[model samples]
Target: MKIRSDILRIYQSLHTWVGISAGLLLFIGFFAGALTMFKQPLDHWVSPPAPVPAMLREQEINSLAQQALAQHPAARKGFIMHLGEHENTVATMSWTAGKPGRELDFSGKQWMANLDQEGKLQAKEELPSILAQMIDMLHRTGGIPGKIGDEYLGGYLMGVAGILYFLALVSGLILLLPTLAKDFFALRPGKNRKRFWLDAHNIIGITSLPYHIVISITVIVFAFHDQFYDSLAEVVYKNQAMFGAPPPAAAKPYAAKDMLPLTSIISKVKAEAGDSRISEIQFFGLESPRPMARVALVNPRYLVQGPEAGYLIVHPYTGVIINASMLPGKESTWSAIVGPFFSLHFGSYGGDMMRWVYFAFGLSGAFLFYSGNLLWLEKRRKVQRPNQPLPVQTLSTRLMAAGTVGVCLGTVAGVCFTLVAGKLFAAAAENINFVYLFVYYSVFLSALAWSYLLGAARASVDLLWLCVLAALAIPCSSVIMALQSPSSNNLTGPGIELVAIAMALTFIYAARKTGKRIRDETKDSVWSLQQIQ
Candidate 1:
């Protein structure tokens, strides 16, 4: 409570510059990251319904798998058996083939198979939707595109931002320490505009400090994990493998018929994983010497290895669990030590309720960044006196204002428009994933250009309206699609639509408030319409 004046000044400058440097990038990441909380629902919401195949009896599943494997050689590489019905499940079984790529890549062709009325296999090849993957990519990359070798350029850039984010958090906390106790709960709303904004920003930042700290650390780790591993290999392990070599291959290849029954595999997984519900059972290298199965299960009480579910790998023929390190309550010491980072960063441990809490925290974090930039711009404003010439705002302040409005609002509008496009073009587009990227960048760049040309004061109102319209299009498109085909709509569609409606209303309010600021409060600042004139 009694820091030297010079010390406070040093931290204030550090907090300002560091936060400004990283704020916009983090805004995009946080906004997109929030949306990823409901990725499964988003996948289902964007997917068009296909005719469900006749349900297979318990005995028929193995028959279907055998036929699929016999006819399609690629099925031997890997395939997933769907154990439950969902909107995104095109068939009871599916496998992807073609050029190999990363898990997030949408390049491969998907083949779906299910039993027909006569218990014969019906298989078809189609392209998978990229909506959810695209959103996740934005979250990971912070809207920065391109790659350096196997890694994303945006990822490394975000990792740097994450470092600055951590510094900003520390410096910001230091600046607040002197008056934090007295002013922590103080949110004075009056004619002094700067005080109000600072108070609001401080409240949100301090309240979510723990969440922010976790995100900042995890982001750096995820972005440069490859580098971390490489350094460990070079310095710590030297000539040895980090996790040890893979298991040795079997003497001979195994056929699909040699694999245990689907029911038996599920039972084994449940027994091993304990009170968990299985969603998918994926088999890999079935025809290779080392055949394996990965079972994905969900249990709220346990920490998950994947984004949505905990996983266990097993030997397909023997039904013996080969690796339970990633399973809940069965994790190895190393996994147990490392699991909380993933769980906290992903909100993967506590089920849907935790997802919603993370979602709220994500939005609040995004707003914190947005307000940081706004506060920076306001702090540098050149005030005008009555009957005097208008104060000339600095180029840096003008640019910051435009960049903040353009980048933040543009991301919001771009995602909303892309969501609408995914539904509208689901049946018509030959390459829907390409359509998604094209639509998003087209809108995003256009908005950025609009903000620069119009200036932040005027552009803010227009972009907010754009966000409103774009968000409104989501629910409206769903309604139109539902009217066209009654059975096509699922529960997820309405859930997404309701959120979009709420978002649209929020933007509408923002547009009005921004217009009021420009008209009444910001006459002397970069946000004043008179500055553009």
Candidate 2:
């Protein structure tokens, strides 16, 4: 297992630099991504009570839909019918008349409908919470904001980071190979802080290497899949359509009432999908000549096309299956090849237990990056001899320490603050989503500036305290809401609050440890108040 000294040194340099370059961004992405595992619960916790009744029978759902379609022309375009299965189900049926833009665009009017006590259709427009979407965006983009043309700017930056991450993984593994047998599971925790950190980092990285590799590869693909496809079209397909032409439109448009019953559609989908459970039925172009219904089914036993579920599209009028390529046990060859990647990245299989595992892995991944940066800083630290003057830490080391503290802790505090803000402003704010973005950036940027101004040691303690308060606010907000409207709370609300409470306690412990380190650690290093002075 011995390797050349020169090769080991080369890999060590490569692993260090590449990991430093990608570490902070990946930290944010992984931390936020972990939170996204329970996005439905967070969404439900922040959302207000449904404007329309949530409970509705099949016949009532039909009545509500038909009445809304007749009264509101926008409902004819497309709408999602909630089967009351998910925690975030706001209404029996809802539709959005948004600006003709990307599907993820939030600039739109949403309408929800359900049957009232008198069996009359009750419909209203409401603002949906964007807290979960914000977290998902962070996971996708690594907190790099803004857009480049039609795409996210963060996506392009993260694509480059993903490449570096892959390189770092390779070089790190190469470096670890020489001592793999002797020190694979060894963790020496003592006065040699550098050795301790390195041991912990290596252990986590090596154990989770497969998970990291999948994330690195999939991130690159997800970020730049459009460019990849465009290149394929020009080079491989000679500018031809990759999947061939889509089907032609029908001869005439159909009325909403002409569509098959909800029960009939669900039955057909179940018959086609076997034991997969239906969550929602999303109708697209219901008034158009070529209308389709996408039935979202969740079956943790198999890989899913999307993060939460797999889907099959069918003709809304005839109940004939349109596209079953994404359905489990019925995927096309290409889809079968690509589906597992999505399933693995999204943790879409193995039910809630798998989701919890992914959550733990995500947090561990974040810690891996954070500890990597700490190791980098420690490697560059200047230790003073007993008879010599105090050594000054390098500017690069100081800056890296500050940046790591700022970016990592800032993201944590920012997300916690945003959650608290969402609950506080849900009732009063006209656009709670805007409030979320504003609060997040304000706290995030402020934390970053504070880190640079006060240095990592001081800023770490301060921001950790801020994180504790922000996390504590979450459960307190829920408790207040429960007291004000006892009936408005749901099971998911308490679950989210309990997690927040645990997070608050963790931050409290972190703050105390950071304060202790600042006070007792060596003055020659960047992680001490004397260094800043």
Candidate 3:
């Protein structure tokens, strides 16, 4: 019995310490991941770059391909085209270098070009849909470039924290198992703040357990992507060779380059591929004034057809079908499946309805981590002895507490700041991304200082108000911009509006609770005075 008691105490201590260590990171990663689902809509909200639908004409593609071939020589080695979705159609062009084994990126020279109805390339000024791509980059790496290693390192830590997170969740549920029978979905207000927080934590945690579990598994898979790939390669491919052949180096270099009619190749590709919409056409080795060009048609059927559909490639000079491969080959299929995990984690696969579901789960996970720390603090309050009153929480806990509060509140503020900057800054908004990120880190640091100086309760109250302020500012700023110039079609303006509404509602809720607590304490003071009189 004594041994069992000791074991239980040790387990509890480990849980508390690990929970404190990982709680904040888990919160930030999960919340940002949740918002990542609405990447396109948010893109639309920030900047409605006129989107093109999935359909394209052969003649138009032919001209573009021929022009690209005439311009670039390296495009023949490897080519890729992505026909944007129906609601937002856009063409992306990429090709390989003339020589292989020289560059890591298989798609050689790349550029985003808008196509006219006749498939002619539009000028650079005509197509400016990079804002959505910009936000996506921010979501992936906190908008930092050349430092993805740091982001991945954070992801690795978050993965460890995820393991700890799953453990903490299970242990928490185990502790609550006995009480669940008495209080499922129970939230009794007017109780002590500790009791209220405990109830809120339990209800949200238990209710969202399934979502939490799935997200945990997905995040783990994403964090250790190599393991996931290795397992696939081992089990499915039987540890055999790669699925697709590497494109050849200088397969066909024309001694006297001649301009190929792009129109003929499109007809040939469409006839051979059958009902497949072309996403992009790359002119292989097209950078040189005279280069052989190959056009690749992205098959839409393969997109929905279970990774078995292959693209149709046509020789622009001869209008001959060059290379064709189905999608299910070992590498292509694996790439497609693995690619969706991040989108799934962020809720980007499904439309708006799905995004909201992911957002709810994401926020719930954040709350679970935050509450876990509070539960530890509460437990310590009860157990601390006069001789050892929880020696000023370990340095790690102090940093984490501040970091958590700072990151959570700071992120809300940064999003608003970025949106405002995007509108006012316009062409210069890319720089704003960096500024927003710095401000976010600063806010997180501030939270740490505030938490250490102010009691946790007071700090929580103060920060919640600040979050409300930032959140509200997002929409207000957007609306102000819209009102000033109705012609500005910045989607970010409206996106900020949505964020502002969410913030205002959250603020109202916090204010009510804080107000009531203040009133209750004042009433208690009056009762004590009356008794003294």
Model 2 CA deviation exceeding 4 Å by range? 50-55, 100-107, 235-245, 251-257, 382-391, 490-494
Work out the TM-score per prediction. 0.93, 0.93, 0.70
Off by over 4 Å in 3: 1-15, 48-56, 72-82, 85-111, 115-120, 125-151, 227-239, 242-350, 386-401, 428-432, 446-458, 490-496, 511-533
lDDT of each model, Cα atoms only? Answer: 0.85, 0.85, 0.54
Where is model 1 poorest over a 10-residue stretch in terms of lDDT? 382-391
Best-to-worst lDDT order: 1, 2, 3
Q: Give the Cα RMSD of candidate 2.
A: 2.7
lDDT of 2 at 134: 79
Off by over 4 Å in 1: 51-58, 103-107, 237-245, 251-257, 382-391, 490-493, 521-523
lDDT of 1 by residue, 1-533 (tens): 78999999999999999999999999999999999998878877777766555566767888788889889988988899987555567788999886446436655669999888788888999888878888998998987878899888998999999999999999999999989999997999988877888999999999999999999999999989998999989999899766544467889888876778777887788788778777788888888898889898777797766786778888888887778877877778767877778888899978779999999999999999999998888777644233556555767778889999999999999999998998878788888888888989999999999999989998999999999999999988888778888875433446788889999999999899889988875455878887732
Give lDDT tens digits, candidate 3, residues 159-255.
6767777777666666566568787788877656668778898899888887777667766765666766688688887746444443344455543
